[model samples]
Target: MCRVPPLSPRTSPTISWKNCINESDPPNLQCGSIQVPVDYGKPHCEHFNLTFARIKTNGISCLGSLVYNPGGPGGAGSDVVFAHVLKGISVWSAELLAQYDLIGLDPRGTGLSNPMKCDPTIWNQRVSMTPQNEEEFNQLVENNKAFSESCRNLTGPIFDFMDTASAAKDMDMVRRALQEDKLNFLGQSYDSQLGSRYAGLFPQNIGRMVLDGITDVSLPGTAQLLIKSNTYESTLNEFFKWCNTTIQCALINQDAPGIFDKLIGTANTNPIPAPGCSPLSEHPCRSDATSEEILTEVQLGLIGFNGTVSFTGWPALSLGILEASKGNATLLSRPIITTPTSSDFSFLGVACFDCKATSISHIDLLLKRQMTSTLSPHTLGATQTYQAQAQCTGWAAPATNTNHALKPKKIAQLPELLLVNSLWDPSTSIVWANLLREQLLSARLVLRKGAGHTSYFAAGETSRAMDGFLLRGELPEQGTTFKS
Candidate 1:
């Protein structure tokens, strides 16, 4: 039911770009902003400017523009351009750089677009996501409401329109401003969900689109969460297996799963001490890290893409766990900045808006929690996807862009799409990839037989297959699988 505003004379606003002079930014880096309606239904509604950064190709024949969204539902594409791509490190193949203007547009309310706000003091409170009782569930609801209210007070109307549909509309606005017939997109992680939204809305405007680490928007929110919980639980077992055999694994001499179970129990009872943390400090970590924090830490460590990738390895995770057992939980600490100025809080404003919401009575929430626990015994159903759904239980904003199967009439108009996925991706699973492929008209799936959230960063055969599609309009053979 999302209706994009009809194109009019004022649709394509001119973009004025200037050099990005941040110390780390490349010399050719250009940054600009485009204004789009806060609500497309009412085009005259107050507009917000989305920020973008790019490095224009010097080659004579440019392939128009390629927009890359490093999926956070909240990750700043502009930040990725400045920090990695423009630096000539963690870059696209040189030929892509030579042929296209690689642009990164920070979605509305994230990165440079006034970044969404919530009261850090209220957000930092330790409300258990896995509420075991009515009282605990009430606390969770109260915390979410307080945070939502704070956001509404500070962010104004644009906060209500932070959904993916609004964002896809913003992308089309960028396309018009860029004067391109089609937009070439590279969306990772949650961006797959965003890409799907864009395809449904402006299928004709899509050029070459790649949805990596795919999410099946077709699934119900609860179904997605349960499946992800199962994925995490299964991945945790893989980690346990690796730890038991690897000599470098700190838990090699001990039973890894048994130790993790005991640690979770100990944390629930006594909580772990984080001597290196200061809760009041900017970018603060909790001093008394609870079982919730430990479970969250475990997920972060289990981002096990491959042995060669420079992510926190299984050995490091074992070390983090062993250290937490004694006293210090510093190694497990992730600076959870919930301040108004920090983009840390934007995930809620964006993610909840993308979810399909239904009224959940307290009893229903308890049942959902019970189902989550029953499905994921080890992680306790603590994937970010599940936590996001549960947090949206009492969310104040309406879910404008909901999770549903893509319509064939609209999706049929989309050009060929390249769907890339890791077979063992911890967050978005291969199951979602296959389901998403079924929804699209002409799409190919590239499965990397490895571990990790994304396959592109692997920068090997999988990356090349993605590059082949974008650079020369080539599609990988339908069921290509690459070894990590």
Candidate 2:
């Protein structure tokens, strides 16, 4: 159970704001910023700025501003909406651009909202963990240690305070600033957790809400990490299935398993060049084929709200892989960054602050216990283990009461919530969507049978269903799963 910490003693309910309207910025969509208290409990204290953008509805019957968040924990929703989603919406694209205000805010410590900037060089450097020997493995540990230290040293108390719960409070502040009675949440991936938390915190204020590619906040740390590890295995298997069919993939290796082995083997022994020959040196290329680099690239390709967004960038990926197998490291220089964007990282600080911050000692003990058990051999020393361990060790956050992290007792009282999942989503799985549905009890599910993280935007029945749900508060029939 997640317990709410004593609200920061330094927050103001009334948000202050600063606006910059360059009438000449091509007017793609209206954008602005809001200054919210860095701490929510103290209504009359110090404040931090958060940026927000709104795309008003056109002629269609306005159903209140959809306060959309495209889950990053670190991913920028405002940037995504302005650059992609809202930009693609037909009604909002032309006439309704002015009518419907599509709100995008860089939650605290993200984007321009009291942004957290780490040393770019230190933050972007990535060292592969697929070590050639024990020495290399030790080096991998050092790399991780250094990376964690770098983040801690560079970022300040702001980094320590960024968490989803606080961000939810910021969302509420956004609603008030826009003068909306309630919020229509369009949240994906990690953002789903945010949306669910918001609903749990303030069910009465929920307008139409859709949570895509759900995250199960109810799961204990060990179980949640297990699910994430298992997801990687499943998604990689699925990726190989696709790779095996393509002539390029087939020529490389006829079988799915062998393709993986060959890719890993070649990358381990040699440096592959980046894929494209662009003048820019940082772009993906063939010459950068370190097994670690290849693995990172492929993982990024395979994982998302739905597995397909990576596909959009696959040609470059394939080219990079092909070049690497042939021995070129120059082409893959660009993908080596270790730190995630603001979207990829949410409030690790706040997560720790909300629930007691995790510790490496606990993680080490859990990993040791798991290793001694009969759990999958692959489960012992994995990415999720390292991720959780690092955060616990790196962040010196005080834990909030455990109850602060727990889900509420009643979900049926809220509006009919739609839970979207991709059959092949790698980050948050169909299993997670199921878990979320079970928790909400009254919520409906829409399964997109395609590649991607969240399938709402992907082509197929899922897309159609999402369109229907958003346009009209209709939920897909239970047990109805759509294939890509």
Candidate 3:
């Protein structure tokens, strides 16, 4: 059994919880900030405020705080709580709504916390994450290095410490500040890694933890990339399946797959013109749509499905593909890039700091591209892994936490964990859920066989099962499956 480490005495600056309730804020919402050490190795050296929002239950009985982290490593938990939970409280079960106070904390260096900033121009550059040749690859490396240096110069030494381990410790601090002996957490996507690390570090303090859209930290960079690419390819295949069967799809019975392939070929040789895009626009609305841009849009559209009865952007994607096939790129180039915010920097900073990158040699890059193409020939291996590799090629900061290699050592005293994953999830793969389950011996796996990213928010059976477990300590039988 792995022994949980004892928490150090509270040497960080004290934080006071203030009631910042406003008309726009969620009902029964209380907003506040807590001070935590920037570097846990030196708790008293320097501190920053971690902002949080809580929606206290109005029921007669209270069952402590349920802290939530909505992935992104850069995602603002407070924003999720306000926008999703509080706004859609009716979707939740009465038992869950009555019991736990939903708390969302913006991890250090994100959102209302001491957010790190960098030059927006660096991000605005129209560089392809998937470089086609050596020259483009070298340019990507230089651009990535410049971006990292900009972050280091702007954020200083603090940039080196925004790893997941630091965020996990900040979670513990939030628990202590809320005067709770145990923490109940719901972490999605990359935040699942955060929650898993927290559970490994402080098993004794865990109450009820649910990790949805499971991320397997055990996989090597290359393996991770391959798995993600293959999974995305599967999702694309699923989309094709839908297009062939469903009348709603504009490309139904039109050789959708062949059309998509020809569209990519055309964009590669001659970039399609997008008259709808404007140079003066704040968005990344380009005047032309490259093959890479169309691929990215399709990938994003597939990932954004809500697991509802109908897919969200399938029609749009079908129309976009049809339009691109006809030489009109107007729909395909509709501002894929949103305005860059602090979260953009935080995402890159935290991700690069948490995971060690493989060597960026030309041979290695070529091998990776070859592997990705082989595994996912249709998609051409374009996934988040490629993006991470491109951005972190010359990352300036060394990793503060090497906890990504943590295996699930049997800890008998740990609380039961609930893991959820959508079978066709575009971002996090179902294989990751299985890998994580193997490590977490006490965990119950809920497989939602449907489309979408995370399962809980869609108010499906997965959400019901999660609510049952979180509120009433009701664990579904091991290996249970739910249909979304």
Candidate 4:
């Protein structure tokens, strides 16, 4: 613990430091909390206390705090410190760790911060996300609205302000509270959503920022969903190609997509059974899987391999497909658990606030279903983009952070940033990365011609590029496309 970080100044004079809430928190870490307005517009009405964990550099050299966001709009950095960082399992390298204070943030509606809440009883009800008819559509909307009401009744007004924009504004408060002139940041997946909003709000305070797994939030909701659905369909073909060539694949020498399509047809006519399997087991194995659940599971598996995060490899995915084909969906159905609160509602809560879905009637939904399914037959629009929009159908909170083009004037003085993304990222499509490049005019993109959610998750040439840039103010020249 020699040369550990000093006790940092509080985020506010009134705020104070304390031991981390979790018992296994890192030894040399200091945890604290600060109260930000529940609604930025109504700063004085009420507030939410946000908590954070920090670990200082071991070296005498310092480059301010490296603010990290683990992406899920719901991902809590403080939890990450105890769960992953302290265990030597993280994306941050030793060199960057030596010179920066690591700030572990719990966003307003997540982590140890006053979290979003919904009645487990209400949440447990299962209504089809893809309603088949007008009656089913009304049921889905009713359930979603009831779920939203439960969250609002328990989480209060802070529920409405849980969007990425508010979190971005809250990020600036942490920056100023730490007394850093610039906010050095590492944001992955959905974190880019927050980072872009921050850049649009406070460009002059920009520091060396790296946005990995780049998800562009500026696109219209329908466009975003279709783009992601197309990417997933493409990536699924890549997985099928691997199955055809690799001996490890259970479906080797067999027509994988044909078999998959057949399984979907069977599932539609008669749901596949998972004998003696629990729906929400330790690994989330489930029983009676639907065609929709199968695609969702495939989407999770296609997050790819060899990153800091664990993803189901192609071999495992093939085996799962084989299992489901044999009428045993034990391996194919997961994360589509029976209960809603049992799943990560925070992802939906943050997504609903961010998407601000309007009350479209059954007619509009029927068209969306037809359009997306035709656009992506194999995957059937099983992207988070579609899921988020569908889930927010009847949210009660007003949409405060609606999608729009990024303000170029706000980003004019912004420092150059390194935007890293996977060409075949199942979650964040490469198309969005291109659009984001155009949005952040000064930012340079280094496209990794590989598969995975984020490049920085694994320490390769791409991660090293991000590392060098964040540790120092290094970025490639404009129009220089880097591939690894």
> Whose TM-score is greatest here?
1
TM-score of 4: 0.91
lDDT against the true structure, each candidate: 0.79, 0.59, 0.78, 0.77
lDDT of 4 at 394: 83
lDDT of 2 by residue, 193-261 (tens): 888778778777787788888877566666665676666557666666766666545234545455455
Instruction: Compose the digit string of candidate 4's lDDT tens values, residues 247-341.
Output: 98899999999999999889876779977477446654556788777788788887865424446576787888998898888777654344333
Tens digits of per-residue lDDT for model 3 on 252-289? 98898899888888887788998777867655477898
User: How do the candidates rank by lDDT, highest first?
Assistant: 1, 3, 4, 2
Models, CA RMSD each: 3.1, 5.6, 4.2, 5.1
**Candidate 4: regions farther than 4 A off:** 1-15, 21-24, 279-285, 307-310, 336-343, 477-484
> How do the candidates rank by TM-score, highest first?
1, 4, 3, 2
**Candidate 1: which pairs clash?**
305-451, 305-452
lDDT per residue, candidate 1, 368-391, as tens digits?
A: 657877877778777788678767
Alpha carbon lDDT at 383, candidate 1: 77
Write down the TM-score for model 1: 0.92
